[model samples]
Target: MNSLAALLDWYATLTPASLDRIAQFYAADAHFRDPFNDVHGVPAIATVFRHMFAHTEAPRFEIAERIEQGEQAFVTWTFHFGLRGRAYAVAGGSHLRFGADGRVIMHRDYWDAAEELWQQLPVLGPPVRWLRKRFRAA
Candidate 1:
């Protein structure tokens, strides 16, 4: 299989026990950034996932769409998880650059915390909804 397919498959099946294999997919000095975290290296990247495992229940990612050309790729995905028995799914995308060795050298994720996460909360939801409506043309 191609490296991109292999990487996506690994992410689809990622579990705490499989974190040790992070080095196989990411370069030694890879950089990663997302809405809440910006980190470097495979170890730091693994720590982010470790924290996710600790804070959320049954967290998993599903790839929805992908595009690749040359050394760069972008993928849209949905992160599914549960919090206090409530299930949630957040849609987002990532831009990745691969190294000559086929491992990812840079990864950046794009998602809105307010719209995707905080807007799900009781207090934050109302205000977020209000602000969105406040800006809408209608």
Candidate 2:
């Protein structure tokens, strides 16, 4: 399979709802990283995912763009979720290294956790958001 297509297909199996499927896309000793986590092994990765899902709702992974060269691929994505019935969205990027097994052995993600999640909290939401806009405007 094309590395890009395989990477995306593997990512599609990883979501708040289908977390168990993540194991199928990773090696036993896979290394996984994201905005808030850096871990080794599929079980550890699953634990991190569980923690995230427990605290959020409707967390879906949408692949927005991708680039591939041989055994590696890069993907830009938007993670959608809701809190207190209000919807929120965050854009993130992931860099993936694939193994000959066609599974991801290493995955790293880059994004602003504070803005994507913490800033969306009830009391801090407005202030953080305002500050972000203010900073961007200044």
Candidate 3:
């Protein structure tokens, strides 16, 4: 398989608690960005991951589609997570740049944190969901 497919497959194998393997996929100088974090380097990236695993339960990453051109690839994915037996699904996409060794050198995700996750939490749950639905219908 191609490196892009291999990377996506490897990522799909990640579980909520697979910190070691997840760390392995990252380059030492890797950078990551998302709604909550705009971090550089593996250590900072791992910290963001630690926080995610700590808060999210039953996390699953599904690579729905992928395209590659040159050293960069775009992956469309669905993030599945649950908390307190309530499940939430979010569709997101990642832009990745691969190093010579095929590890991720840079990764960024695009998704609506408010609708996908923050809305599922305790205090902000209802209002966030209502707003998301309202705006989506407009």
For candidate 1, give the lDDT.
Answer: 0.92
Using TM-score as the measure, the top candidate is 1
Q: Every model's Cα RMSD, please?
A: 1.5, 2.7, 2.7
Clashing pairs for predicted structure model 3, backbone only: none
Question: Candidate 3: lDDT of 48?
Answer: 81
Instruction: Please tell me which model should have the higher lDDT, number 1 or number 3.
Output: 1
In model 1, the worst 10-residue window by lDDT is: 1-10
Error of 2 at 19 (Å): 2.6
Task: For candidate 1, write residues 6-95 as lDDT tens digits.
Answer: 899989999999888999999999999999999999989999999999999999999999999999899999999998888989999999
Residue-level error in angstroms, candidate 3, position 136: 6.6
Q: lDDT values of the candidates?
A: 0.92, 0.80, 0.81
Per-residue alpha-carbon lDDT of model 2 for 13-122, expressed as tens digits?
A: 56666777776678889999886788999989999878867877776678888888887888999888776688888898988888887788899999997787778788
The residue-level lDDT of candidate 1 at 4 comes to 88
How many residue-pair clashes does candidate 3 contain?
Answer: 0
TM-score for each prediction? 0.94, 0.79, 0.81
**Per-residue C-alpha lDDT of model 3 across residues 1-138, encoded as one tens digit per residue:** 127775677778765456666555778988899887898888888788677678888777888988888888889999888877888898999999988877788999999888677887888989998887888956
